[model samples]
Each structure stands twice: as C-alpha cells, then as structure tokens.
Target: MKALVTTEDSGFGLRMADVPEPEPRPGQALVEVRAVAVNRGELSMMAMLPPGSQLGWDIAGTVLRPAADGSGPAAGTRVTGLADGAGWSELAAADTARLTPVPDDLDWTAATAIPVVGLTALYALRHAGLLLGRTVLVTGAGGGVGRMAVQLAAASGARVVAWVGSAERAKGLRELGAAAVSTYDAEETGPVDVLVDSVGGQVLNRAYRLVVPGGKVIVYGNTTRSELNLPVDWGHARPGVQLRYVHLFHELPAHPVTRDLGFLVQRVADGLLDPQVATVAPWTDAEPALRALAQRQVNGKVVLTI
Candidate 1:
C-alpha cells in the first residue's frame, strides 16, 4: 500500500510501493484505514526520528481482522480511536482494546481528530471539580485540544470563556458554547473557577491570576512559546488553587478508571465528544499538511485521508 514516509531531511514524502501491511500480533487488531489526524505530538516525534518512520495515533477505520485470542477488535466494525504506529497508511495495526466504534453519521476526517484531544479535554475538565456551576477559562481556545476543551467544559455545564489568538475563531468558539471570547490578556480580568491552559509562556502565567483562590488549573498542552515562566504571586498568598499538567500518552491504558478508552469512544459515538477537523488532505498531499503543522500554520487537527 502507498504510505507517506518521513524523508531523510525531516519532511514527509510519498512512497508508493509495497509496504508490509500491519497484522494483529496477539492482543491486537488490523484496521482498514480511512483517515487519521496529524497532531503536534506526531510532529514532534517526526522531528526526533530518522527518515521513513511513521508517526500518528488517532485513526478512523474499520476492523478488518481480530487476533486469535479474541483480545482484538471484532472484525468489520467501523471504528475511530487511538493506536500506536503505522498510522499514515491504508492499513494499520493496534491492540483491539484500544479501538473505539465510530458513529455512522460522522465522517472519518472528524473521527480521526477525536481521541487524544477529547481525552485530554476529559482529563482537564475532570480535574476541575464540580463543573456544573463553575466558570472555566480555556487558553489557546481555537486549537484542536482547546476547542474540544471548551465544548467538554460547557457540556458539563461550566460557563465557558475562551481565549483565542485570532478574532476569526471567536464566532466558532461561541457556537461551541463558550460564553465569552477574548484575547489572552483580556480574558484574564474575569473570575475563573478553573483554568485550562493550552498555550504556554506568558499566556499561562496570565491565566494563573484569573482562577479563584480555591479553583484548579490544568495544563495539558503547550502550543505557545515552549519556555514558560511562573508568576511568583501565583503561590504568594492564600491556600492556592491546584496546578497540574498532563500529557495524554502518559495515562493511556493505565490509571484504571479514568484511562478507559472504551468510555471515550462510546462518548464519541454518542456525540458527547466532538472532533474538530481543521483540514483534510489525501495521503499523497499529507506532506504539505505535515509542513503546515510544523510551521505552526494550522488552526486545528489536520486529517490525512488514506
């Protein structure tokens, strides 16, 4: 099958040739690929790996085969979920337990964008305690995870305030149920019961001031400037709010209850979790999308259709 391979010089190149189709190796399943999301984590992995290595996790496909031990996905189910590797192809293999069924109404491009971002949003909001009557501020509100964060917070009944970098995204954020939209600096003036930080650097420091004394602050991704500084006043007085940062991969298939990928996938099928896709490119054009992701030119998750 034709697949996009990372080139010798840290870029994606199409390799239209015979590549071994992945098969379920005990506790795994083989999926007939439909679409996959291009995420920052995959981009960062690309930067660290040698040429021709594939990197991606979110996949929307069909279960073509299940393992003999009956530990893999049942064959012939339309699915959308997370996996470990070989994600940029027409066929991929993953542990069956990792697969999640996709609702028939949603397209693969949308399905491909759900897993990691939605899971991160779930963790961030879960950390924020009693979300129903709270007010939550989401920084980098327009990006993939941030966009999902806003919706999840609102679904749990939190009054959502989204801080977006561009004015154009304000309308979309509001449509997703954000109560208000503002720039990072401007959004800091409001009272926040919880803060979800996607952009790091000064924006994160700025968010620290908005949280109510007993509130919570969760940082799941750093999309802004990488090097971040903490405000001295954040810990200066009062029994300060809780500050916790997370990486989605760190908790996957672990932590017992909260790490339930099955629950997450069920939510996707039920429309409780929504995937926001910024762009979709065929496998042949995935290189451009990868370049755009690396250049920080993308607005949300980019989907590569196989």
Candidate 2:
C-alpha cells in the first residue's frame, strides 16, 4: 500500500512510500481509507517523527474487515473516525470503539473532516459546561476546530463571539451562527460564560480573563505560542473560574468517541452542521497541501483524497 511517510530529506518532511498493509487487531477494524484530513498539529510534528512513519489522525473510508472481537461494524460498512496514526495510507487499522458510521449520502471529503476537529469542538464545549442562552467565546475561529466550535455553540443556544486573524475569514462566521466575529487584535471586554480557546499564548491569556467568575475556560491547542503565559494574578483574580486543558487522545477512554463522532456525522447529514472543507486535493499533492496548512493559509478543513 502507498502511504504518506515522513522523510528527513524531503522539503516538506513528507513523501509517499510503499508500506505493508495493516492488519486488524482483536478490537480493531481494517479500513480502506478513502480520504484523510490534514491538521496543523500533525504537520508540526513531521520533522520529529521517525523516518518512514505514517502520519495522519482523521480518516473516512469503508470497512474491509470487522473487528475480531465482533464489536464494530461489519465488513463493507462505511465509516469515519480518529486513528492513532497511519491514516495517511490506503489502509489503516482503526480501533472499533473510535469508529463512527458515515452517512450514505455524505461525501468522503466531508466525512473525513468530522472526526478529529468535530470531536474536539464537541468535547471542549462539554468541558466548559455550555448552557442555553449563555455567552461563549471561541478563539481561532477561522480554523477547523474553531469553526466547528462556533457553529456547535450556536446550535446549542449560546451566543457565540468568534476571534479570527483576518477580516476576510470572518465573513461567513456570523452566518454560521456567531453573534460577533472580530480580529484577534480586537478588544473583547464583556465577560463570557464559557471560553473555548484553540489558539494559545496571548489569545488564551486574554480569553481566560474574560470568563465570568464561575465560568470555565477550556484550552485545547497551542497554535501560536509554544509557551503559554498566563496573567500573574489569574488564580487570585478569578478564584471561582475553572481552568481546564484538553488533550483529545488522553480523554478518548473517558468519552465515547464512536457515539460522539456518530452524532456529529448525523448533524452534517441533516445539514445542521457543516464540515467546512476548505480544500480537496489528491493524496499526490500532500506536500503542497501540508505546506499550505503549516503556513496557516487554509480557513477550514483540508482533505486529501486517496
């Protein structure tokens, strides 16, 4: 099978290589990957990955074989889900518990966009204790997880305030249900009931200060700054405010990955949620697609067709 692998000499730190096909384990299913999504986190780690290692986390495809334990969808079923790695290949071994059935009508590009980013947005909102009529602020709203957070927060009846890097990217954020969309440099003085932050560094610090006294602030990504600096008086100034950090892989066991991904897939099928695919290119163009993603040029999810 041809898979996208990390290479030390490649300019993008990635190249195509022939690799052995994966075999399903007792609780895993072997999937014939149809599409995969590119994420900034994975791209950032490319240089550090072992040579020839497969790289990707989100995938949508058909199940070629069921789990040995009889716990997952049968062979020939369409599915989409998160993988530990190796999703960039033509075949990937997916944990049955993390696999979600894809709607028959949904395209591979759209379905592939829902796994990692969708689950991250959903879980972040849940961690923040989102409630109807509450005010929610989402930073880095132009990115995949940020865009999903905006729409999901609004669908849940929260007033959403989106922070993006450019005015051009803020155009359709309101139509997606954001009550207000502003540049990251814009001032946001009002207190929010919940803050979902994907951009770390200064943005995270600023958003954290805006959470209401008893509200929660959930930090998920550190796209801008590797080292996040918080206010010196953060703990004392907002004693009641709860600060939580989410690493999706670590929380998968506590949450139902399959059930959550399935719900989001259904929402997309019903037109209530949008996967917001920004670019679709063949897997052969993985280098350029990854370059664009690393440059932060994409407004939404970027899918590579197999």
The stretch of ten residues in a row with the least summed lDDT in candidate 2 is 182-191
How far is each candidate from the true structure, as Cα RMSD in Å?
2.6, 1.4
Q: Model 1 has how many clashing residue pairs?
A: 0
Pairs of residues at least 3 apart in sequence or in different chains that clash in candidate 2: none
lDDT (0 to 1) per candidate: 0.76, 0.87
Runs off by more than 4 Å, candidate 2: 185-189
Q: In candidate 1, what are the lDDT values of residues 1-306, reduced to their tens digit?
A: 756666664335434445777666787778888998887877777657776676668888998887667874578888876766777777888766667776677678877788778877877677777899898999888778888889889988989999987786554788888888898765444888888997888888777777777778898878765786766767654266788887777766454322355566566667766666777988776678778776756667889888
- Give model 2's TM-score versus the native structure: 0.96
Best-performing candidate as measured by TM-score: 2
| Model 1, position 206: C-alpha lDDT score | 77
Question: How well is each residue in 74-152 modelled by candidate 2, as lDDT tens digits?
Answer: 9999999976688999999999999999989999999999988998889888887746989999999998999999999
Q: Give the Cα error of residue 182 in candidate 2, in Å.
A: 0.6
